[model samples]
Target: MSNSPTLGYLIPQFPGQTHIFFWREILALERMGINVALFSTRPPPPGLISHVWSDEAMKRTEYLGNMDPRRAAKATLGVSPALWAKDVLREGRVLAKDLAIASAAAQKLKESCAARGIQHVHAHSCARSALVALLAQQLGGPTYSLTLHGPLSDYGPGQRLKWRHAKFATVITEKLRKELPELLGEDQPEKIFVQPMGVDVNALIRDVPYHPHQSPQQLRIFACGRLNIVKGHQDLMAAIRLLRDKGIDVRLDIAGEDDDGGSGYRKELENRITELDLQDHVALLGAISAEEVRRYLLSAHVFTLASWHEPLGVAYMEAMSCEVPTIGTNAGGVPELIRDGIDGLLVEPKSPDALANAIMLLARNPKDAQRLGQAGRTRIIERFNCEKGAELIAREALDLRVSEEI
Candidate 1:
């Protein structure tokens, strides 16, 4: 390997079902000549490594939960007292528990990165992982940066705190980037660049090419996300009910795992499925692999996720890349990803009527639907491909490494 400065990636979790975009970015970065060391602040899911990509990731990842307790204690105390106090005062009462755990993990993660010759550490999110990066910088390991993907307000006062310490930061949407100064409560928040997450568009098209629309067939619809309230699976069920009531035959395949967030929600989704008597029309494929998701994307007449307050979703692009027309709520970065009438449709969040209407509109107009699918695939290729997105962020990381050194 070339002896360039190594870049370390710190995430709150490593290789979960929804993080395929991240893994794609990591692969692209590696191809672009960056040696990346991965660190995780969360515990691995039960069964330990379900997907091939995740299994490969697990082999190289460092988990905070896996560190020895004695070593963790020693590292916790190893931080300079002044720096620890600064974080406490900076976070105040809100992030005490998170701050403490992240601080300890940062020190341990720093040691891991050092052994691997990592010169810069980066994390995705303004919360725990970013906190770990900030703490690692304090422990004199490596300078760090972060990428903000969601509502900064959700990160609480910690968002502002991370901004102050991160050597640089990235936001996934133009709206988020434009609002960075307000979000960070800091001047020159332009230092926090706009770099959206994405998938390997070319690979997707090659592996799962657009199947030409066959003559009048029952529509196959697919939705994917964690089985939780914010994902709006219930609302989707309601829309499906409306479709069936209207005699517009459709089959909905909802693919996602119900982790901690799915406990009661998954059961509720099942209840709704039975109540709607959509047993034949809908199937809940719990926790499918990425390849399975691609199959659904390619097979489906249209793909959609009616998420509430979602940050940019990778699934939308994955579907569109396969020339599958997609739909999403006009929430967060969805609008940025989908052109309302051109590529994919956008509906109001939490409104099953609007969702059902959009589905019906597409269902009735097969030619328009195919046209939209084609446009969506073209959009992913022209703008949202993994290498293009990855190259931008990788450039930022490389520049940050040099700037910090200077």
Candidate 2:
């Protein structure tokens, strides 16, 4: 530790499954000799911290949402009442709860960061995490920034407040970049920069034994993600039905955890498979390890996810990194990653025919599949490499530190 300050990460979930990019960025920044402290508002959801990397993060993180009575009292007394009330007013009703308590606990967060000599804070999500940043700033803490991750639909009310004093707001994709002005007002153009969630393309794809062209007698199609309606798993199942109807002898492997123990949408997927009489053809391999996911990707003939609202899918990136000829909808940030008919294939959202056609085309033509898959790996390496994204972010953070000097 020199005379400089550490960076603080204010996040809702520290070791979340969908937040692997955050960990990668943190690790990369650490490897670059930057000190980062994790301040999570909530502990991770059940089963989200299974990975060894996540366990390491959990050890370093402090959960503000779980403060003890004496600590809470000290935190409460540390906040200036006027400042807390001001933040509550600025945050309004939607974020008032998050802002109020976190603002009151601002001293606790500040004390933790201050102990590490952290000067600037970067939050992961715009809503809860950014609100914490805003409130912490109000309490005379770190100068804070935020990343706008998804569509600003649920975050409209809160984001505008966050942007008013945020050091900068990084968009997770170009799609969100275009909407920054519309979502955060027309004046926020200068505050926004597109930064997609990155994957370690080289590490993920390197030297994985490739699945040789499978016989038409057995085609294994793989999709891994949260089993939910928004991911369009049902539509994916419909595509499987199309492939089976044509007697393509395709087998689908769906690896993911249900939101509510196979009760809601996961049940729907299982019922749909049963309804199509394709139960034997489709296997729902629930929630495998990250290594297992990599294995599945490397071994599969095709990787497909027909999501309707993918802001950007790390799953798609991972699949492409493994050089599995991938299929994704023209949804959200997917178009930015996949150049349809060039690197991989893109189908219309919820269009089983297009997805099925893409699957069949790749299945019958192994040479084309290999060609597209290799292109995808090259594209990921050049464009979406995790180290590159982390370097850009670290540059921006250092730039902000110099400019803000707080």
Candidate 3:
């Protein structure tokens, strides 16, 4: 363990309700004899920090948002004027205020890595965190890499500069990996690996065997994701309505809050629920801890999310790990995770009737439901678990190239 390389792990927000995958990967890295030094731009808003391990994670993470002005000034002045001006142009699409903050964060990161003797930093996002890592490396900090969780557009501008400078990059889906060559052209990183995010299969198992709903009455369905229009919570609600009209007594519990605690898009969903007269059938449980999500998955007969687009759904992986028959839309990288009519089911995005029919099919056939549930857990164990992802990261981070492909 003493000889293991100490790697800087950077995240935009260290510990939030939806960041369990990051925590899992960190743990996996540590278990494999890699020392992980946690770094973050800032803490998440108080309401968004719902994980039980959040307090411990926050304690380990060094926040760089609040830097001493004198130190920040010195670090900013230390960079070559020509390089600074070039970066300013490289980041034309980014806000001026955000660039200033990223500069300060880079300074803090440079000093921290020097003091800690970290040789490499890997950012879990390609957003401003990647920019900060880029700046830090420019300031003579540790060499850095990046992981792309979603589309390049979601990460804002300077894609060419970030990818061109990073030691390597990993994407959560092959589809995204394939897009990089066309987007970055000749500016692509030297190493770009396709590695999907994964769940902790050992922790997400069911205590008892799963059985399908015996009766149509009180058939419970569960969904977990942010309350955003892109996540398609409204479409799922409409599907619940469609199921209700067919004389099937069903209940849906959505377990996530809007971006601003509950003030933002939750109001829109509450109004829509009222408009559809689904007050009794659907409940918004707000942001929940991972254990609570597991409990919900264990109790529910079906787990589904109607996201209009998802990069790669960790939520779906978690449900499948819990042996709950899962359903997802054929959007983004979800098809790579779920093979239709095999491990689980996939429907077209934004179709409420399609969602309703899939739910009904599982509700009617208990035997097929059980088969898919068992197969889903097996799929997670064999391929999509977190350990495999961590292995890929370790190999790439340490430059331990093997002749055979991973």
Candidate 4:
């Protein structure tokens, strides 16, 4: 414990609703006696930050997004002009904006690492936070690593620049890891590990045994994810409409808010609920605490998310941890997480008919749903434990002296 170096934990938005996994990993690292210095690009929108621990997380995080003109100039000057030109030409105009943001934070990050005795900076995002870590490492900061949570394209351009000099990196799925070499070509980082983010199985345990809502007419579905077009909430809503049309009363509670709070895409969803005449069947629970989610998971008959594409879903894992039968779309890396018809059910993405059918399969068969729920819980407890995920980060990124018993 005494020999371990402080690890700088970086995430773009520190404690947003979907970031409970990050918080669990931080706690796990601390439990392993690895000191973690939290850093974020900036505070998230006030409306978007909804976890119970968000305030505490914000207090601990050091925001580094504020651009200092003098430090920005020095940081930009430190990079070779030829490399900058090459990056711009290769990656496009987006590289310039990313570089500018990275340059603004680099020197500040370096000073913070030095002051805090942080030996390694691990960026939990492949987006601009990765760029921030890369530039900071270049400016004599701690050695940096990255964890790719989704598709590289989602992170924007400068893939080569981001991965070229990293100490190591982790992708959430083997699919992503296998594709990395082809994507980055010659500039791929040397040490890339496959590590999925996970939820706290211990904390997410159900206090009471799960039983499908006894009413044959009602199917209570619980879903948790950010409100976005890609999450397939609209599809889920359509599926709900289908269920109702088939004479099954479906009640769906979706816990999330749009990136811009309720002012943006949420209105579209709300209107859709009205357009579908699902005023009583659907409720959009804006940005709920993890505890509330756990409560919903405990009470719900089925848990599901219809992501158009998901890179190993933590929301599904969280529900499974609560011994809830989960239905997920067969989108990116999700098959790696759930065994179709065994631990959980998988439906094709954006297919309301498929989703409706899958939901009905569970709704009509309580025994099968219970079996899946039990199997899902066992799967999460054995394989996707958050503590184990944290230990991987500690061992690989922070070089922590973890006990063999772990």
Candidate 1: pairs in clash: none
Order of the predicted models by lDDT, top scorer first: 4, 3, 1, 2
**How would you encode candidate 2's per-residue C-alpha lDDT over 136-177 as one tens digit per residue?**
676667888778778887564555667877877787788778
CA shift of 47, model 4, Å: 0.8
Q: Name the runs in model 3 displaced over 4 angstroms.
A: 1-3, 81-97, 400-406
The superposed Cα distance between candidate 2 and the true structure at residue 251, in angstroms, equals 1.7
On residues 1-406, what C-alpha lDDT tens digit does candidate 4 reach at each position?
5565688999997777789899999998888777789999899888888888999999999999898999899888786776567888876777898888788787788889998788899999888888888888877778998999888888988888888988888888888888887789998878888878888888999889898755665779999999999999999999999988998878999999999978999999999999999999899999999999999999899999999999999999999999899999999999999999889999999999999999989888889999999999999988888887788877787565467432
lDDT of 3 by residue, 1-406 (tens): 6676788999997787789999999998887778889999889888788888999999999998786787667667876756545645756635344556688889889999999888789999888898789888888998999999999989976677778889999899999988888889888888888888899998999998787988845899999998899889999999999998999999999998888988999999999999999999999999899999999999999999999999989999999999999999999999999989999999999999999999999999999899999999998998889988778877777764333332
- Candidate 1: list runs displaced more than 4 Å: 2-4, 47-50, 66-87, 187-190, 206-216, 400-406
In candidate 2, how many Å is residue 348 off?
0.5
- TM-scores, in order shown? 0.91, 0.89, 0.95, 0.96
What residue runs in model 4 are displaced by over 4 Å at the alpha carbon? 1-4, 82-85, 404-406
Question: Where does candidate 3 clash, by residue pair?
Answer: none
lDDT of 3 at 249: 96
CA-lDDT, candidates in order = 0.78, 0.76, 0.88, 0.88
Preferred candidate (TM-score higher): 2 or 4:
4
TM-score of 3: 0.95
Which of the two candidates, 3 or 4, achieves a greater TM-score against the reference? 4
